[model samples]
Target: MKYSKATDYALHTMLFLVAATPNKPIGVQQLADRQNVSPTYLSKILTKLVKAGMVESASGANGGYRLKRNWENISFLDIIHAVEGTASLFDCSFDHGSECPIQQVVLSAEAKMEEHLRNQTMFDLAKKNKNKIVW
Candidate 1:
């Protein structure tokens, strides 16, 4: 399933935060500039993350945002859930309240997707990317 732009930004924001010094808050403007994203849009995404308890925010000149949990403790699914509700591949709606014949197959795929997401974490992503890129 395709995620909204907000979810996309939130994922990047999380990755960027994890790459920074742990427990150190990074300003929105600084982060936006580094990621080449609009500070205003990034701020909205950060607010949602803070609300999800995935991020913490501080106000003032030296204030900014930081990850509330370690990268290893945070998963890609967590970021998606924080921004978008569920990561279901597809939502099947049947006519007249009748269940679809292939409901079980759809549900199975959704479960597998969730399991995959749960198995991966931000730290895993960072390490995997740092390893190499094969053409």
Candidate 2:
């Protein structure tokens, strides 16, 4: 149910990239400033995104981060997994193996949530909030 702050930053950073300028690279400082977070910390998150092929980093004065060519097809679940990993949210403490009823329920819920997230992309979100958000 609960996710990391890194995931939160990553999601917002991705949204900003998609909404503000998908092709244009934005510096880590600017991205951090928007969320009031540390540029160094945000950089670490960006690194993960880069490794995941969700975004790419450029060098030099106008260098920064920008979405990849397939960013429009990137689902929320993709971003979430990129930062959070593909580990299950809940793991039953008891040694009930794969037959654990409690684990089954939780896993089912997680699957549904992931399915919903998989249906929602940053491009869709940006388009929906285009008028509402400044970017």
Candidate 3:
């Protein structure tokens, strides 16, 4: 299943922030530039994360975005749900409330995916990718 571009940006933003110095906020422009995304678009994504309680923002000269929780506590699933909601690959609902035959199968797959994502966290990923990625 494919997620929206917003979701991709949100994940990237989270990963970037996970690497930042604690209590030190990163400016939107700086983050946008580093991520190679539009500042306006990134700001909207950051707002969504902030509202989801995954990230926090500050105001004034030192104003910027930071994670609300530690990277170890922030699961990849959390970021996905924060940006995309609990959207399934296939909609199980039908008109008149009719039960779809494939609903169970789809739901099972979704559950598996959720379980896998929930088991993984930003800190875990950072450790795994530390040597491979630049940051």
Q: Which of the predicted structures, 1 or 3, would earn the higher TM-score when compared with the native?
A: 3
Q: Write model 1 residue lDDT over 12-58, tens digit each, in one string.
A: 77777766564889999988887788999999889888888988998
TM-score of candidate 1 against the unseen true structure: 0.84
Backbone clash total, candidate 1: 0
- Candidates sorted by lDDT, descending order? 2, 3, 1
- In model 2, which range of ten residues has the least summed lDDT? 126-135
Best by TM-score: 2
Residue-wise C-alpha lDDT for candidate 2, range 15-133, written one tens digit per residue: 99999989999999999999999999999999999999999999999999999998999999999999999999997999998899999999999999999999999999999999876
Q: CA shift at 19, candidate 3, in angstroms?
A: 1.8
Clashes of 3: 0
Clashes of 2: 0
TM-score of 2: 0.96
